[model samples]
Target chain A: MNEQLAFTIEVFLNGLMAGVLYALVALGFVLIYKASGIFNYAQGVMALFAAMTLVGIQNGQVPFAHLINAIFGTDVHKFGWHVHSFAAILLTVIVMIALAWMVQQFVFKHLVGQEPIILFMATIGLAYFLEGVADLMWGSELKALNVCASEGNCLPQGMNVWLEGTTYEALGYGFFIDNLDIVASIVAAVLVAGLVIFAQYTKQGRAMRAVADDHQAALSVGVSLNFIWVLVWSLAGFVALVAGIMWGAKSGVQFSLSLIALKALPVLMLGGFTSIPGAIIGGLIIGVGEKLFEFLIGAPFLGGATENWFAYMLALVFLVFRPQGLFGEKIIERV
Target chain B: MLDDAKQADAQVDNVLEVNNIEVIYNHVILVLKGVSLNVPKGGITALLGGNGAGKTTTLKAISGLLASERGEVTKGSIKYRGQDIQHADPAETVKQGVVQVMEGRHCFEHLTIEENLMTGAYTRTDGNAAIAADLELVYNYFPRLKERRKSQAGYTSGGEQQMCAVGRALMSKPETILLDEPSMGLAPQLVEQIFDIVKSINEQEGVTFLLAEQNTNVALRFAHYGYILESGRVVMDGPAKDLRENQDVKEFYLGMSDEGRKSFRDVRSYRRRKRWLS
Candidate 1:
């Protein structure tokens, strides 16, 4: 292949890889939305919270060290020991589960039967609350998450080292790709498969889907609504944590980690709020579409920020023809 | 007939009982006005009423779905198998062997017919083998459901949805089912077919039922006993035969009188006419 065409293919592959990350976050949204009718805008912040908590626990940093030092002029900062990565991850999972339980107890439990738009807005409030708590707990500093499957900070790197030696030498061009992206993509695929199996086969999964279909019917059939809601929220939290770890390691754990949640909004609009497969497929489409657009048009012509609005514009146009989304059930109106 | 006559003389052993229940909706709107009724063990009893006559509200009260809608029985009591269940959650009520097949046939539209049926047995810890047996039993009653077992409930017609709803309720193995408007919005033939299935389920499975309906014609035909509600009060009640023969019920409810297709063989019609005359 020619140089330009090879470059284009590389960009396209990178776009698809980015799409996998979007799908990770979108899965969190889909899980919570499907089970509880909660369009959780807090999902991104939940990820941020998880990532911050994971790093703080790993590094043996005192919770609220900065706030304590500022308030009391204390010299205390570190706990003087480090937690193993596996231990920190387990602890983070516990924290996420506890957070899920608390969120249900405090925020969502009282808001049952509220409108979807209202729930969505409530989640936005929850996002702010979670962000504040995360900042208070972890001092809100940029932290490098270090729990990679292989090497170089949370994921394997230097995948292009091999490509440059053999495949690229034959073609007079090397395909540059991050092993982290490839690893993240595999983790996402595994996460989605696990979720699908849980939803399709397990009793609890069926109960969750039943709750989604008809709350009253599910209740009458003897599935406790509150229990199912908690289970769903915790599952979403775990998903958010996975997303957090991946994104945090990529960009350094910071406030911007939560903005990736915004990138997922167009994915939801395209995929439909209640669909799992839709979230994945929608994420992929948005991921690839934005990348290709930026490469072919934005960088060369309309400026480099077309990636900011391309997904949204595409979702808007698609929804005009199919309002329920690509895989969402077509809504049937009854008088 | 003899047993029903004995039931008319006194309460013939009820599996579920509602006594003078007053319900309020949204803390202000009073919906059920001291309503009372009984379901004879292993028999079908129909509660007949017009729209807004509190039939659905009464079922919601018994099933514990009212609270989710902000409706609560603020007065009186409901007993299932001699246990007070007025404040029980809907899931609790289901576990206690009383399930309500809700009005409007709220089948899980996204679920296949079989999955919807399986959900009805969600609370049961009984072996899968028995649950499977009960599922086949449900399919036998509503064979159309078995034919469309894999089809999504949303795409099915109204009659099939109703059948699926009832079949789902049966998966719980409930002793008493509070059926709300099973005959609503269906062809006359389908209505009769549904009632026939209900009757057989009552007879063969030995399941008791308290069905609230507006169709007095079909309800009275299949029900062993009938209670007529008007504006949330139990205005009239008797064994099905006596209720069918009553003058006021014949005219106002069934829309039949002496001149209609209904026979006036009973000489008591004159005395009943005098009661209306005064």
Candidate 2:
């Protein structure tokens, strides 16, 4: 490819990678929303919390150490012992599970049977509460995630090197691609496939679908509603953690890390809130579409940073024409 | 083992007994005022009433699904195999071989016909072979379901949806099935087809049934015994033959009375008259 074409292709590929990250977060929203009918605005913060906890545990940083020092005027910071990446990830998983349990027990248990709007508002409150809690537990600072290290840094150079050597050499120009994006693409593919299998083949997965279909019917058929809700939230938590690791490693762990979750909202609206594959395909569309728009029109006409609003516009237009979304179940209204 | 032995003792003669149960919805609205009924083993009993007669509530109460609707059996005992199950979870009720096909044919519309049937066997810990065999059994009774097994339940017709509901319940291999309004909103021919299937299931499978319906004529044809409820109270109940012939039932429920109807409506202080008692 020529220089301009190579750049465009690079932008498209990068956009696709960004879309995968969005889909990862969107999957959590779909899982919780489908099972519990709670549009969890806290899903993004769950990712932030997971990444923060992973960093804290990995570096032997005491939770609320900063707060403790501020309150008592002490100089204590670290616990003086470092935990490995694998151990940190495991510990983070446990923390996320515990968080899921506590959320169900404290926040949602009392709000059962409430309208979807009320639950949606509750999740917004939960988002703020979780963000605050995460900040207090681990100091509100940008923490770099050192996991998934390829060579010295996680930005995979191999794909770029390979493209430069072979494919790009043929075109007299190389398309730049981040190895992190390549890794994320692989992780995303596996995660989605694993989720599909887990849903299709597992008993718990079947129960989740049943709960999603009709709560009262599922209850009558010997499916425990509360248990299924907890299971779904925990599964969403695990998805959030994987997303946290990938995003945190890509862009350092911070409150802004949670902002990536906002990217998923349009993806969800585009894909339909309840469909899993919609989340995936919707993610890819938003990713590639935004990049292409920015390169072709956004930068020249609107100056830049068009990726922010382009997705929401696309979703809005799509919804106006097709309210059911690309793959969402057709809603039948009975008067 | 002990619980199983106790339940086995309760399981004889009558598969289910709802005794003097008073159900209250939202902690205030009285729905079932001291309603009592028995579902004999391997016998089909129909609870007949118009809308707001608490038939669905009674079914929900027996199936332990009252909690979902903020309804509770404030004063009553629902026994399954002679054990008090009023306070048990809905899931626990199903686990003990009692399944309810809910009103409005609440099939998992998103699921295929076959998947919906498989969901009925969700509570069973039985071997896959037996579950597969039961799937075939359900298919035999409702061959329409077998042909449309891969089709989504939502897209199916109302009669098929009702059949899917019953078929799903049969997949559980329950000792007793609570079917609410099996004839609602279906063509008369389809309603008769469903009733025939219910009767066949009762005779062939020996499954006890407590079906609630407003169509007195069709329900009476298949049901061995019938109860007539008005305003949450069972005013009269008897063998289907006797109830079918009674003048009051014939006039009020079945909408057929040879006697002139004008004088009966014009009677003074008629609320005091117990025509059946007289």
Interface RMSD of each: 1.9, 2.0
TM-score for each of the candidates: 0.91, 0.90
TM-score of chain B of each: 0.91, 0.91
Off by over 4 Å in 2: A64-77, A150-170, A332-335, B1-12, B260-278
Write candidate 1's Cα lDDT for A1-335 as tens digits.
79899899888888988998899899999998887878899999999999999999998999988789999999888999888777889999999999989998988877777788988898999999999999998887688887654233322477434322322333777887766687789989999999999988888888888898889888877889888988999999999999998888778899999999999999988998888999999999999999999999999999799999999999899889877788785665433
Q: In Å, what is the interface RMSD of model 1? A: 1.9
What is candidate 1's DockQ?
Answer: 0.54
| Candidate 2 TM-score to native | 0.90
**lDDT of all predictions:** 0.87, 0.86
Candidate with best lDDT: 1
lDDT of 1 by residue, B1-278 (tens): 78656675437588889999999988999888888898888888999978898999999999998878888899999999899999998888999999999888999888889999998889889899999999999988988999999988888999999999999999999988889999889899999999999999988998888999989988998988899886677778888888988887887778777776544444257535644554
True contacts kept of 2: 0.55
